[model samples]
Target: MGVCFSTEIKDKSSFHTGVDTDGNDHSTNSSKVSSVPPTPRSEGEILQSLNLKSFSFSDLKTSTRNFRPDSVLGEGGFGSVFKGWIDEQSFAATKPGTGMVIAVKKLNQESFQGHREWLAEVNYLGQFSHPNLVQLIGYCLEDEQRLLVYEFMPRGSLENHLFRRGSYFQPLSWSLRLKAALGAAKGLAFLHSAKTKVIYRDFKTSNVLLDSNYNAKLSDFGLAKDGPIGDKSHVSTRVMGTYGYTAPEYLATGHLTSKSDVYSFGVVLLEMISGQRAIDKNRQFGKHSLVEWAKPYMAHKRKVLRVIDSRLEGQYTLEAAHAVANISYRCLSIEPRFRPSMAEVVKELEKLQEPKETRPRRHSSHGTRTRRLSSGGLAAADDAGLGAYPRPQASLPSK
Candidate 1:
């Protein structure tokens, strides 16, 4: 839910980059400053009331047959997402999937997300347009009901395919998995490299929605923040993040920065490659966690292959697997400085998939299968024309 980092949106110290996010200049760790937040049009109010161009409740209700439970697509941290339709005015072009099918996310009034979070979602997703980011059509907020309209993702979330109970879903092949990783990486890089950096506070399998082709669309920007500019290296704030994915520095000290997002991304990447949950409360004692179990292997670089998902056995090239494992190790490194930037990660994955003409490598050629074990416990293995991942074998639950 938190992508391992948990937080409640606090009243920021009067910062605004536009209608989307606000920056705090006068606020500090010791100084508590509060002023009225910038009054901006909430996406819901604007779409439903301000614009005749948007779909009305009656229009959506008629199409959805009065919000029938049968039309409900799925439920998540926000609320239920239902499949509904809109006329040509909503989406021109042509009709393929039932005339502009939209996803209606009904917010839980009793839940932790309130008006501010709802407004933030509308402001950001409403204007933020990208093929990889989920499209926000409009919203509706009346009385106890708060709803966000988004583009329907037919294939559902990556989590459903990865780790739903009793779900005998089709396994993601090596190439397809790599492709998904690449696409998701591209989305992260875009956000990090935007004119103004946007920190994705929550990044996990559930947040990565997949369309019919399994393309990733990052959703839920309730916790998205404007990163520090100029000489500012960190954003000072109380520690508010999920447990497993939170950076040690952020958790130990309230120094928020880009590295915090990188740490979460690393955990997500590890889960993608290995098909493991970041934290498994049901796991016995110490074994109930992906991070705790994989840390030893990442540090030493021996037996890291043992952590690879058994379901993918032999489906992935040894060299490719080793390179990805090595990258994952760097991503999960406890120190933020040790982790590679998102751009570096994208490059490594692209290289691991192809040859040096596109991306260079740590090894001269792939498939060498020669492992060099250093005294420090780093093992480098080559199976493709890429790099080596030398990690110690850390024991985990059996297949």
Candidate 2:
């Protein structure tokens, strides 16, 4: 399950609108178009503008097999995501494993903040179409029931691949990790681009969903906020995000910025490199907080092995590992201004994807042979450099 914090939406006023419920022009002045389009004011108008299918409660209930427990894909604070099938063309309910597969997130009625978050997801995802961002198929808002339908992510989340230990959850290969990281970074870069300019307040591993080919797509826009407008530097809001992933300045002053998302991305990148949770209380005193524990190792060239995942022993190259560590270290900088923009981060990650010649193994003082490398420069390490470090047993509870 994933976690997120909630804050009250200050202004609930409606905005300008033009679209109709069915997304058709019922207006008599269809020929005349305004140079400036009207902003979406009400929920219905916003939903109308996107041209998303308006699904009824009965329609979704049929699509999700009456919301059976067996059909569930995952659960979070907002609701349970159930696996379902729907018609590819008509968007109607279909038998399981047939037609197009979809994930139906049925909002928990008891959650006071769920409705606002649901709308936020619809608002952002409905309008924005990006390969790295999860696709919003449609939505359901019949009476009090609110549900969001999204394209099915067969491989699940980056969180499970990094932390979960089981046959179903395999540790992602080094190359795959880099691929996922780059894909996620591209997603963030798209959101942070001048046209989008949205701050993804919550950017943990769990929100990074994977498709069959292991391509990463960012999901859950509940905490996403519009970037500071005009001369404003940051959007002042209540501190809301997973504890370990939230940026320090945002946590202290409640000023949210795109740099805040960069910090969270660094935390996720660290999690991928170390195969550890961001906030693992079960670890030893000095190792509880992943960022704090790994900072020393990340900065030190030789000591970098102490933080790299043992499971990824021979999978990554030394130079590539160090480069990724440096990226994370810079992104995790205390000063938000010091953090590199997502676009810059994307460029650095893209460089790592380039093919590199393999270098011969070298032996350390401890006599353990360096691990073999397939690409990305020199070989990694064995038990020589990586000291006996205990893996964290517990993870932060999902909200």
Candidate 3:
């Protein structure tokens, strides 16, 4: 779970300002869109929102088959997510494998931060409806118990698909990676475009879930914060997020902005191209930081191939690789002012997906041929003499 420093209740601000790193003002909307309601201050007021259902604790228990171990789908800092069945029309509990399937997250009783996170999830998801955001079907709030119900995502998380090594978890194709990246970018763009401007504090690959057709949807809003209002430049809050993905400026100062989310997005994008964790201690010397080790290579057209996942086997064109490198480099800029807005990033990614003629592959200075290591591992070695890097083991808990 994400760490929280302020003990104060959630902010009650009515509106927020969204200034991109490049000084573009995104907070204003000329379209005649309905204004969002002010955030509810209490649990009672939040639960009263008409968009969500109030599920009795007993009903969820029955739906999840008494929270049996066999029904568990995944586990995380919040708690275990159990596969459950519910009636589509009445939203009533049903037998296993019957009716609509849902993922029920039962909060851990011992987690001190679980309640706050759970409330944040409901508060944000209840009011927002978008194709890229996870759907919250209902929530159960009983004395000393907190649980949330969500539409089940069949393909699991992008983290698993990109990092996990197994027959069930296939490597994401280059096209699929671009698709997921675009979907996630659109989701952040939606949050930033909101009249009240929500800063998604946590944006690592683990929080990006995938559906049956490989469509990406963002999950986990526990660390989300309302953007600064009025003339304030940013919302001052405690630094809280996964270590490698957190922006340097936010880590130094408690000031938070939408650009912080942009930095995290850059890290995820780099991970997709390299098939490496943001910070892998297991890596050899001088190669632990994905951004540090790969950014220089990304600067040059031919050298960029050095960092591309050898697993890709040159399936992606040199031009497309260079374009992605440019985007990530801008996003991971030391000065936030140099980074492009999410809207701009989305437009750049869309250009990559447009139909175009296939061009002949450009051979790198270091030959483009890739060969398997003798050890029967998935290591891919090229003529450049880059050493074999082991595949990362699954370290983070699933959402």
**1-399 per-residue lDDT for model 1 (tens digits):** 111001111111111111112333433232111211322333334433332224455555665556677666554444455666765464432222467777666665654434556676776566666777887777776667777777766555565455533322345545556766777777777778847476665566666766656577787766566667789987665444444666777666656677787788878778877777787777778767787787676544346666777656545555666778788778877788888888888898887665325433223223433232221220111111011111111111111
Evaluated at residue 169, the lDDT of candidate 2 is 26
Candidate 2: residue pairs that collide: 15-41
By summed lDDT, which 10 consecutive residues of candidate 2 come out lowest?
6-15
Worst window of 10 by summed lDDT in candidate 1: 381-390
Candidate lDDT values, in order:
0.57, 0.71, 0.70
Model 3 weakest 10-residue run by lDDT = 5-14
Q: What would the TM-score be for candidate 2 when compared with the true structure?
A: 0.80
Clashes of each: 23, 1, 0
Q: Which lDDT value does model 2 have at 333? A: 99
Ranking by lDDT: 2, 3, 1
Question: Candidate 2: where are CA atoms >4 Å away?
Answer: 1-47, 167-169, 356-399
Tell how far residue 268 is off in model 1, in angstroms.
1.1
**Candidate 2 residue lDDT tens string, 258-326:** 999999999999999999988887899999899999998898877898889886776666777888999
What is the C-alpha lDDT profile of model 3 across 1-399, one tens digit per residue?
311111111211111122333333333241111111123422434656548888999999999899987776655545667778999999999999899988887887865445666787888877789998999888988999998888887666677567765443235667778889999999998898847488887788877877766678888776687887778888776555665787889877667899999999999999998898898888999998999999888889889988888767645778888899888888999888888888889999988874435434533335574332222121221111111111222221110
